[model samples]
Target: MKALTASSLTGLALLALTGCGESVSNRLMAPTDGPSATKAGTPIMRGLTSSAGVVPTAYDGNTSGDGSSSCSALGFGSTGTKVDGAYSQKVGGYQFTVSGSEKQYLAFAPSGTPTSTILAVIVKGGDAYDVYNYRNNPRTSDAGLTSPYNHGGNIPTISHYVVCYGPYTPPIFTKTLVGVMKEGATIGSMEDDLSWRDHPDLVIIPWGRTRWLDWQLSYTLPPGVTGIITENATTVCGSLGTFRLQCTFNENPATYPIYTWSGLSGQGAVLVMNDLGGGGAGSCGDHDYTNTATLALSNGTTLTASKTITVRVVCPTTP
Candidate 1:
């Protein structure tokens, strides 16, 4: 983040007062008295496909039947007891059954590619239900269910199922300020540096007033800088009101150059960075700054974006 010199400010004020056209560089280079207004755009939902075909496997919850208690207390069934081995069915080439006493189970056959990745599953019923990744680590089992019971009156039946891989690298943006005006306005266009490893699962739903998703932002300061003032603009929907999101960021003396915002959805779903730093001033420094934004779904699928920015301040000299 760069600051404008006294001379530059004087010239900018003159141009504005005289109704003269301003250059883009001048607009971006201008110092902001406060944070800038959010740029609005439609939120995107991307789809993901498995690297290879996967076959479903059967996981019986009855410890006596399988001689393994790994799923003893993990099923959500009518009797509230572990599912009987007979509770097996096939749907869309995937095997589905009850596991433990409170969880549903699905199994995927081995694939040629053995790379590690997160799997997201959705079990739809009267209301959409998201499955949980009980095994937190990257898995090859390809089978699991929601952590808690859907508890939709009757045994929650699988209305729909979808899977995708995750824990992806986020997109980064870097822009050189060449113009300015007052603070809290559009500075300039940003150059995107997209660096990611995996594809995020696509989630499509009808647009509604209720907030089906939530997010938070975090800031990282550079080394040696301290006592910096920071503020987060209240999160709100975009003007289009069609699944758009917006927020603000500010730091006095602007120490923290990097910030990240992440989101999570569904029941018992724990994303790595969810709701951090409710927005306030804090100590920061002059170091490589990184910002992260993550979105998680009810079926245990997560999407993340991380940006690292290097702050280079070039103040103008007074002539």
Candidate 2:
């Protein structure tokens, strides 16, 4: 296979994904540094519509979700540069900042500590683009997409994404390990560090205009787990047997921790101790948890772990 270069397709002018357009591989959609393709067209934003014709702006600090009361419009040039709407404001204690003199992006975040977990946008003149929604401590490649090419893995480098026209379908922005809060650090921060890049305009077609972008911050992610086991006791030490084990962590406090079991004994045999992962606590402190492991021995003998576990396994019938 040919080596995929991030820079080659980063500026491919928003070509169509079907027919003559290049189709990306599945690897690109799963967080792999795979190859990418670009379409040849200017980026464009969509317009939202409501029964009232258009969304009206108010002098007082108030914004409406109705399409007639709020709308954003975008235009693009052949050179893939944006021509209008590059300003932002606040509503309901939330901050909206838009960027992209050429191809704009919109970023929204809470004001205080300043961290953006979700990013959305329309490519001013183009129809296709990428939106990266991240969590508090966003990690590289944690973003999602609805590009012509659905490449996953860590979020792609910003420069690699196309700001071209679209007849596009984007997925709902989900929480990643990082977010727009890091849009400003440096080129490296976008791909390495967790600094926000310039908080750009997102593509929320509020009202009848593609002019306004909305990033709701009430969403969060549940913490993930870490750790696994190799095999069970009933199986031969060197024999091929399925070992069952799992561990989890909770990132979002709102969601409680839940556990599932896997192994020869089937499901629900094992329990996820609250003491173990701390129910997704502040420090994720010491993992002093407990659980039972059962291994069915073919031979009339018992097996034990090198590290003493909470419970012992009962030997099955001797061969």
Candidate 3:
């Protein structure tokens, strides 16, 4: 008689179970790390998929039927109970805890009606505990295509819990600075010409997620100087979970001055002013100017920041 080796014994066992089809032993015999294995040396169990060969659905932000039936389908107890607010439950082998002020329960029917619906408990601006998909009903396999709770076409009438938080905080601007230029006297020059051309543009700094809904600027020029020529006002605003706001000196040229004060350096916001060709040579003297900037936010909030700068052009005295 021939001795039966371990390999031969394993082969015989496999043949015997061949008639039983894909059993637990068959999965156990599969390779440790592959599509079939959850990890190294860990094969997935056949029980994760439904015996009826029905897949689950995914969760989308659509709700139906008061969310009770959907929640119940996920095995969260009865339909008539007040399942809203903070609560914890184990669904599809995962422990889920949701806490918040506003709770919303919704039924998710990714495949539309007549198909199984998935219960979704959403908690807004709150935290969820141990929320994850089941290993068996992976989002990969076609059999696990549908959601975990809506398996085998069996509507479990479960309940999902959700919490909703309040609105987000409004945006704000801070840490603003303005730039100025001072001119020196030149040899043999009659007078200094103080034009905005010699100085850099104005700078404005904003902080937080600020969205500028409206912006206006007013300026006071020196005596004999009629008006000022400024570039078009340009602003950038968008939503980054919250609102974000930014504005530049000029839309076309886009030139901003760099300045450092009190050991901090940054490219402060700027306002471009064209040279009006005023301020005669001997008039090379310091001129004070005031600029007022008004900004409005999408949240109906207004902000005001002002900066005063001096522009000077001096002349030399010849003997």
Candidate 4:
């Protein structure tokens, strides 16, 4: 298997061929070529892609051997089980594919706003590894010259690097990192080169919160389906509170029913209808009379400006 960094392939191969292991001549090379020229999976050298996508495995805190039963035991697959090739797994509706060695898994929390969290589990062939807090970017913009990791000794060629923010939290899952380093791939080489070689291309894996809502579901407003717009709201039908008016609509066919309304109101509220009441704008309310949800709209229907929406609800006496 190849190391995370491709630059070390040549020299590492030569050293292995000569049988003179861990020699000085084998180390140190061009910045782009990596310190060693070998293709082995080191902790930092391995790359993981879940069934959902490719996630990174950092070597900074990995502990594994090359070609060991424990290290080789790790892999990713579509089923989240051990496979011959790199394994891939789907956890929390996300897919990942992993390659290389000395692998480990981690979980990360969200950024500045901490309303959500990400849960991920790392796996290997023989045993499951530890899961640690993965995303914690505590980095300040460096005019693009300084290394992000000064806490460690000897830095490699990096374009840019940033520290994760927030406190460190351990993984809730039982697994740690799985997989071992490949032949001729050493931990030292990975630290000096692959781990953060090119900060610009480092590809930081954010183990933080992922959006629950499918924000990509934007469609044109259809006809027959009215677009409702409201302004600052104070009463929501005698609820004794101030909130925004809720709106809902439906689609034809009703085969694949999907609903999306109110970007401002509380999480799951029924949209009001035909009015914003106290000094609001336009019309707003439930669009779908059937049990179905219309995601798209026909032509000739007008939509109100989204900026005019303020979701404040108050109690309605007419209740």
lDDT of 2 by residue, 62-120 (tens): 11222122221112212111213344544222354544442233444444422222211
lDDT tens string, model 4, 71-176? 2233311222222323343322223333223222222222333321222233222211221122231111111111111111122222111112222221111111
Model 3 Cα displacement at 281 (Å)? 20
lDDT score of residue 92 within candidate 2: 22
**TM-scores for every candidate against the unseen true structure:** 0.21, 0.19, 0.21, 0.21
The residue-level lDDT of candidate 3 at 127 comes to 15
Quantify how close model 1 is to the true structure by its C-alpha RMSD in Å.
30.7
Which model is ahead, 3 or 4, in terms of TM-score?
Answer: 3
Q: Point to the candidate with the largest lDDT.
A: 3
CA lDDT, candidate 2, residue 76: 23
Tell me the tens digit of each residue's lDDT in model 1 across 191-308.
Answer: 2112111211111111221111122232231121111111222321111122122223332225333332333111122222111111112211112333344443322333344434
Higher lDDT: candidate 1 or 2? 1
Model 1 TM-score is: 0.21
Q: How far out, in Å, is residue 178 in model 1?
A: 14
- Write down the RMSD of all candidates, one decimal each: 30.7, 26.5, 19.3, 26.4
lDDT score of residue 88 within candidate 1:
49
10 residues in a row with least lDDT, candidate 3:
235-244
Q: What is the C-alpha lDDT of each candidate?
A: 0.28, 0.23, 0.29, 0.24
| Candidate 1 overall lDDT versus native | 0.28
- Alpha carbon lDDT at 309, candidate 3: 42
